[model samples]
Target: MPPRWPRTPDRNDPAFRRLEDFINFALHAAIYLAVNSGLWFFQLLNHPWDNLSIVSGVWLLGLVSHGCYVFILADYRRIEAAAQGNWQQELATELEEDATVTPDEAPSSPEQP
Candidate 1:
């Protein structure tokens, strides 16, 4: 199925796109906290300790974003490695197993008598 959301902006151009990404991260972080911490009931943005929203939002955003970016990179690396030769090694191992004889192998023939 197609993506439920619009395509993420390419990381190639980091000017306008990156700024938007930063803002989106901040909003998601805020909403995540609002939902999880029950702080939406309080005017979190107005309290003396309200800085938690900003701090937590940015912190969690950076942490989550960095982790997702790293995971994507790792997944890409794994795909590339498999494409290069890893799959060949796996296939060779499976074929080697097939080449082995096992006691469970079917009998070559049944006695006629």
Candidate 2:
């Protein structure tokens, strides 16, 4: 079966969250707009002749476009990749070194538990 939710960036990672807040914001905004879509149709009950649906319809279209960028084209890759640039491989190597380092020899950090 397919996943119910879209493939999203890790929220716990500050690099992915704040650096690419637009992706997360767009995703949630789309959901809110989608849920409210029916309200636009219901507006027909009061103003059958006015039909101002183009407002919501155009916003929904923009949401679909943003969704395509986030889920299909994978915009998160560009954000994270730009942060590491050429140091990705070097960072990986450093991570491997940290794995083998004993607690006593490990580097100190205020956040390390």
Candidate 3:
């Protein structure tokens, strides 16, 4: 029988949760890289490394502050739902497809009269 509830995300689906983690990581990395580059430019201009090092600290803090953990959790939750074979989720997917199904390709129902 089809599942009665929506499918939960499968945290095991490496593609799902992992992707979110990757995104979070990339975001943090980008922020860090930008800061580092700016600091490097300043150092080149004779600014002291002492002040520039602060950017690294801020970058580290931003990784946690940006809620990377939350995104990872959310991704895992989605994977769990999918693993549960949730019919509600299946139905929703089918409905979405139906909206796109061409009229000519759609099956007809009986007792139209």
The C-alpha lDDT values of all candidates are: 0.58, 0.61, 0.66
Model 2 lDDT, full chain set: 0.61
lDDT of 2 by residue, 49-90 (tens): 343566667766877786676556654444455455745775
Q: Against the hidden reference, what TM-scores do the models get?
A: 0.27, 0.40, 0.39
**Looking at model 3, which ten-residue stretch has the lowest summed lDDT?**
2-11
User: What does the lDDT come to for candidate 3?
Assistant: 0.66
Q: How close is candidate 3 to the true structure, as a TM-score?
A: 0.39
lDDT of 3 by residue, 1-63 (tens): 953423455546645566556667787778778878887888989867775667677767877
lDDT of 3 at 28: 71
lDDT (tens digit, per residue) of candidate 1 on 51-74: 657866776777687546643432
Off by over 4 Å in 1: 1-13, 39-113
Residue 98 of model 3 has an lDDT of 86
For model 2, name the residue pairs that clash. Answer: none
